[model samples]
Target chain A: MSSPAQQSAGKPVAFVSAQALRARMHDAVNDPHLRQSFRGAMDFLMAKRAAQFPDQGELDSLRSLSESIRQYSLSKLPDLLEQLEANLTRNGVQVHWAETPEEANAIMLGIAQRHAARLIVKGKSMVSEEIEFNHAMEAAGVGALESDMGEYIVQLAGEKPSHIIMPAIHQTKQQIAKLFAEHIPGVDYTDNVDALIQIGRRVLREKFEVADIGLSGVNFAVAETGTLCLVENEGNGRMCTTVPKVHIAITGIEKVVEKLEHVAPLFSILTRSATGQAVSTYFNMISGPRRGEDKDGPEEVHLVLLDNGRSQAYADEQLRKTLQCIRCGACMNHCPVYTRIGGHAYGTTYPGPIGKIISPHMMGLEQTHLLPTASSLCGACGEVCPVKIPIPELLIRLRGEANSAPHANPAMVGQGAAYDPKISLLWKLWARLYARPATYRAFTWLATRFRALTPTQQSGWTAARTPLKPASRRLRDMVKDRR
Target chain B: MSSPSHGANTPRTYPSRPQAVYFYGTCLVDMFVPEAGMDAITLLEREGIRVIFPDNQTCCGQPAFTSGFPDEARRVVEAQLDLFPGNHPIVVPSGSCAGMIRWHWEKVCAGDPALKARAEAISARTYELAEFLLHVLGFNRKDEGPATTVTLHTSCSARREMGTHLVGRELLARLGNVTLAHHDHESECCGFGGTFSLKHPDVSTAMVSDKVASLKATGASQLVTADCGCMLNITQRAAREDQDAGRACASLPGEHLATFLLRRTGGSPCGDQK
Candidate 1:
């Protein structure tokens, strides 16, 4: 028998590791408040998304087309990236490349410092969260303010975004009301969402006027037209890109596409999948810095392409599909695991199915291996994926890769901690036992004969369930007796 | 839906009413719930289709396959594949196991052409019990039992791979007396994902608790499911909860669809005992 510590050591660990994730999940699951909040929100989102695609044929057709476009884009990612850089440069936009999060943050800080920027207004960006951009900026004495309502609330609370699309999904309106009342100057508590939003808008609107540099994320970077598209329901993304003197867009290298036309189908499904909106209120496109004739736009526009572990994913054929994600949280909203525990339990920038498959590439298997194992292989994520990423298959493949023997693939990123020689030997022994009829019969016979000896206190198995004991007689024995 | 071809081979067709079928009584049904296996056989026999049970068969290796040990899974799968050599329809009592044979067998045996061909052959003929009853045999037996209210829990693979949930629903609908109650979040997994339950028990238990709660809300006394893993998890969880409350054993009984079909359709009396 293994000790508790040994058993835990045997399981996969995440970037935050399994121990921390399990502890967090234990608290999250025990909290009826958290569970109910996620349950209601996810159900509402799932229903709204369902209502958008009433025609199954149309949904299937759109999904297939979107999948093909993503596949085509990923196939020529290197050439497309080069083309994107060339086109953006031709449009008078300076394109900077960063191979890691540290480099990405350094590049952004350098640009801010060169411009002598003090206050920076930002749209919602998960990539920024991944790099801890706010903390980095704060260390440099630059105040970065979140303009998106959910991001602003989480920022004020000194908390990370729980859900990717719905950043503050884990917080109730009452909680937000209290947060704002306590944090904001001269503000009364209000539980109404509209009232809460208005308060946030009023506060962020002031930051937009005073900010020297605007920072945002790109939904899609079109190589053909050198266009960077940003989608959002709130106008903060528009304000961040246009209101300031200089605008900087940071995105993973995989976000670049071959043509502007491809963004239409992706955008169509993306908003519908995320928050179930037919279209976002703002579809801001930034092609270049403000020209002499331009009315209202930033004087300097720069695009920062961040590779931070994405090139590693792009190296492997199967892992490349992780790049096909369009940042739509449909997979999370429809995910039973995510709906139950909420997103914070994942302990990563992205959460739910997308996070499970993608985080390992960024953080390495040594840290994020447990994320893939967190799923029950329900395939709901894959089913609802607008771009039709085979998420479950990728998860299983990751599991296999994580458990692969050390030095098995010297090229892979992290050495999986879950790969145990003892467990491998045990599986081999079991397989060998089942390889022949005699040994199989011997084992089944003994198992049935000593069924009463089955332990009543099986770990995890009997915690909330009855013990699974063997039957009094084997099926083969029963068949032979009947014959 | 018909099975798609993998390589150069064309799709194979099974007879509308097969003379015989090799019943792949999955390892779960064999040891844990033999009545389900027996009931499956009884249902087929009543339809005048001969049932052949190869005693050497153990499992389809889904536990290993889904647990990240594909090589071990391939070994076990190969052993099972070697047991059934003929072209008879391979009908399984559980959709979870059947799906492993139909969809994943070829995948695990991808490199070896000979093994892959054998895997595809077996997969093409494999069918979940409900799917076989509805689609293959076109069984239209009249409803014979008294009225019973029940809700069905379709396993993840069953719904996703085989689309047997529809088949289960259609099969149950044919039994005019059985009232199928609608439950919210019916399509979600019950969290009995083989090793997943043991590995992540807290999450699994939470999911099952919600599943049981949904099942209970329908006001159905009995819960029917087509997969043994799900049935065992649901029933055992209910029993343990009942015990915790100091109530009677097995508060909410979850029966396999084969057992439900056998008893409700009057195929055999022995199957009703479980």
Candidate 2:
């Protein structure tokens, strides 16, 4: 976690608070280069995902099944976690529990010190980002390197991942070429995508070979088989988990499923929705560390199950739907708000529709309250969601939660910023006026009669358009005249 | 009276058209665009159905509801509900207002059982103008107006909540002399999300601009939309942009679907009656 001071010192802005979101949004919209980057990338991703689900019937059924499966797993999450722990222990893997990010980091650092690990290679784990593992490791004098190409570029540039699935999605190849030229020991600048991949591969291969510990993120943790399923296209995931002396996998506790069969459909839609691949090149299911009979794998395996407020989401029935997210990035790709502002403006580990809903749970609504309001409630995120998370409904619910009265139970995170006494009183007065026929008629009469008095310099309305002027007469009065 | 029997996802069908329809002139139409409301009444009366204007009707409570004040929304919505208490289909001139009643009313009133029942009852009978014409009345008429090209802007709520975008397209297709030109990103929102527009001005401005650009790309002579909120946003932006570019704002302002349908059909019947 970058402290407030560190965040301010950093070149790229992170650590977003709800109050800062609007200003960030303003800057993001004004930057044409950033707009074009996100717009083109989102359009490409939307087109690709649309092609994969050509048949709407198939898509609907898959979504329904996925929703049911996730709901079922979440309903029995506590029991499933216990089963998973037992099974993993039986398979000779140490499973550690963490209630918060600090605890999770401390546990990982303790493991690192125990093994006297100097360097760790990581396979694209969002959970690691959530804990700010790289910073913690660096502070503890341990070298932590990102093996995924996107993560590596973002890390090298001293910036956080702007996007979820495609971390450096906001960067153009030219910008990346420049970054590589500036950072790499001896690399010629190149804009070719394949050449860039080769450069990343060459550097990460040596790191993987020399690294003492391997860190990874679990896509699905199967309780029945005690397996941690990882999906990736790059071969780095394999190298990081198998070649290193010790392997550590960190994941949110909500990622668990009851049975191995459940992984089939979720995996199918996860890749199809995220980047449009039918299936990823690699699907590594690690059940245990290397045994005497096993040839090429780590000597020991450890799993750090981080809660970090996931239990709070799981406790609420409606909010629990947020946990169904497979991190496919489909919602963000189809989201108009995210497309305009991109990921950096959100200033969270996760950005876009998923970030808005889930971050409130992880980081609390005080910091993320404005995220829900950022949307136009266009429903594109919900429409394209693979797991059928009702994002719009959740947003509305979050808004209501944010505006709840101070006396309300649950002691909500934001204390309802919209629920100002003055605003509430204003709405009450407006509702009262509209609720009665005589007051409603009298108000409209006054509004139409004093049309000229309507201000031309209204705050947001007249900024880009002409002032709103009331009509000469109301429809009811006109109807009476015609009669 | 028998209720319309439409399954969850199936296309709605009416067994027989109701003799009388209650016209809920949305607060926007009742205030800013009375012509659309009058045209709606004229069209319904011409179709041999009695149009009853509920005098006490004001707003649909969507503004309050969507702005995160369900209590305020309930009070306003409950007022309108009592005015249309019967089996008569409640036809709204704008899809946005109709969507408020159809999709969100019950949710808004979920805290109280009696109010929830009232909301569900009222929501069942509510229909957007185009939806009523396409589904209930099964309106199919030959266009008698001049040949013209028109593009349609489907409001976000109408498209997502009410599924009235299809009905609007079908209604437009029924006209003989009208060519319905489709824009590239017609499904995208115009960003008039009630309070959302005011709260996030820059984002709203950018979104409305994109929508206008799409409409201009269609090269249609006229633009028709169902929701007054969207019409207000698009027309205002169009006029502003045209002025900024130092061009004569010759483009016809966006028309509500009801007004467009009435004019294209043969003008309002009230004038003929007079």
Candidate 3:
């Protein structure tokens, strides 16, 4: 409240505090133009997803399959990771392990330094963004650029991806055209979508050709065949992984599956749930660097598996469900809060429903506790998750973790970060009052008797609503009167 | 295939309609929307099923349960566990409260063996009012009221967790005198997420405004909701919106689906209308 951070498109460029988050939400709620765009886009996406799942039975079955595959793979995640490392190494690919964002950045930087990499061309790799890979590489004097059209536009604007799948979804074509006219060299103002994409591609194609290193994200890392599968509608990902002399992929450790066959159900459901596509335009699989008799490919391949608090989530039974996400972004597309406030309001690498649950582990409850409570517990995210992540249930658990007293030897970092003694005492009193029938009845009786005196300024409820007053007669009294 | 999203599509066989059922008037209904509770009981009685109002039943412990105070929630829920001893079905008029008792009690009571058993038994027998009326009682009613177009709005819990979104429609299907108007995005929440309405008022207001406008755009003279919490939020917002637009407040009078059905069936409401 003291220092209002710069606002763009009705959201804070970054979240500073819990108060600022609400302030940002207030701005977002009142931004009619932004609200209309988000509303229309979310509606279009919800319809597309609904159309993809014409058969409820099919959706249920596929969701179940994807859920089991992820759960089964995560159950043996340690072994599968070791197996994956061994298999990838055997297939002439180098595998690196990173436990934190700093470690992940250092490892990637070391690889960049080893290759004497001056420029790195990137695809739509959220993990790279999560570790602030571009900033890290640039600080080390290695130029890193985005090849994904949406990501490129977001980068050019010096902003974070607003949504996961469609990074620039929050931006209007006019905004992009204006951004391009001001930033892109020799580019004129144009609101045409095709023309804009062509301009971005032309600029990025040069980067791909001259870059020393290419970076991409893995959709599914198959341990059985030691392959990294990438699902993309655009060919930019293929170019990033195959065009350069050295290809490097980064992803969370949870993306690994045990068998090649496990990828099918996940791939099909992810595409349909993500963009309403039967399959992505390109489903590129990279088993290793260019083979001995290969046609055209990178000479060396490296994979970085970043932990970054996933292990904390996997430590508990119920919390492990957070890792089942397939990065489909369907949950965000269906979330009511996301539709209203957009994504940058969260100020996390991931945004919306997934961010609410997962950000707590990555950033700790101290920073991300407010994210979980931002939802209405509407179950839209969980109801639409392609992999059955049980998002609502996980959000509830994260809330408990945030508010509960952290005992000795807590499982998560920054546990009980949001706990307040006053709030705890309040719930205690409420429980005591509600647990006893006599107390509750007497309370209701007094409340109804003094209904006229009930305050209209009932905290925040009366902000845009009429005050809720008790009825003259409680239901218990009404039943007795009828009798 | 068992999945969280498709929990609604899973078919559930109903228990045989029993002679007596325990009525769980949620705290919201008990204090604020008592008329809805009265109408629900009257409808059940008219079906020849004796309705037992458990005096000790205060709440399903949802507010505390969802607000990160599990110990407090469990204490409240454990007390309600003793109110219903036998296997006679427990009927709750609100889908959210019903969902908590039916689906979440076992999870909340996961620590204790005896508590878990009792929670499972209670869950197996609990039903939302509309779901019980249609599925168990095979409720059929003749609409003897005037022709009024009305739109039905349900809570997220009712639509997703309880899968009772269609139950209200089915019950209204039997009321020939009433015309049901469709609203845009009917399944979306009315932003009455109990404490969520209080915690984040601005976002909650925005969501409720959209809901009220959508229901109004249908040109329905009246609104019916399955949950009183949503009723509290939507009706108040509708009235406030009307007052803001320089019109008489409460023009689109909102009522519980139970009350709407009862009045349509010629059953006079027992409580005074506010």
Second chain alone, TM-score for each candidate: 0.93, 0.92, 0.95
lDDT of 1 by residue, A1-483 (tens): 111112223232224564477777778888899899999999999999999998877888888888899999999998999999999999989999999888998999999999899888899998988888887777676777888888887777667788999999888888899988877778898998888888888888877998999999999999999999999988899999999999999999999899989999999999998988899999988999999988989999999999878888888887898999999999999889999899888888888999998888888888777778888888788888998888887888888877768776643577555688887888888787776667777888888899898788877778678899887876666666656
Every model's TM-score: 0.95, 0.95, 0.97
Worst-scoring 10-residue span by lDDT in model 3 chain A: A1-10
- A128-240 in candidate 3: lDDT tens per residue? 87887877777677877878888877876778898999999988999999988877778899999999988887887777888999999999999988999999978999999
Stretches of candidate 1 off by over 4 Å are A1-19, B1-15, B269-274
lDDT of 2 by residue, B1-274 (tens): 1211111132555537999999999899888888778888888888898988889988999888877778888899888878986789999988778878887888888888888888888887888888888788888877899999999999877777676668888898899899999997677778778788888888888788888888888899978998888999888888888778876864647888888888888776332343
Query: How do the residues B1-274 of candidate 3 rate in per-residue lDDT, one tens digit apiece?
Result: 1222534365778988799999999999999989999999999999999999999988899998888788899999999998887679999999999988877788788899899888888888889998999999998878898888899987888888878788899888789877889999887878878888899998999999999889989998889888898888998988887878888657678889888888888888765353
Of the two candidates 2 and 3, the one with more favorable TM-score, higher being better, is 3
The CA lDDT at A426 in model 1 is 85
Number of clashes in model 2? 1
Chain B TM-score of candidate number 1: 0.93
Lowest lDDT 10-residue stretch of candidate 2 chain A: A1-10
In model 1, pairs of residues that clash are A14-A17, A14-A367, A15-A367
Candidate ranking (TM-score, best to worst): 3, 1, 2
* lDDT tens digits by residue: candidate 2, A368-426: 88888888887778877888888888888888787766665563455574567887888
- Candidate 1 is graded, for docking, as medium
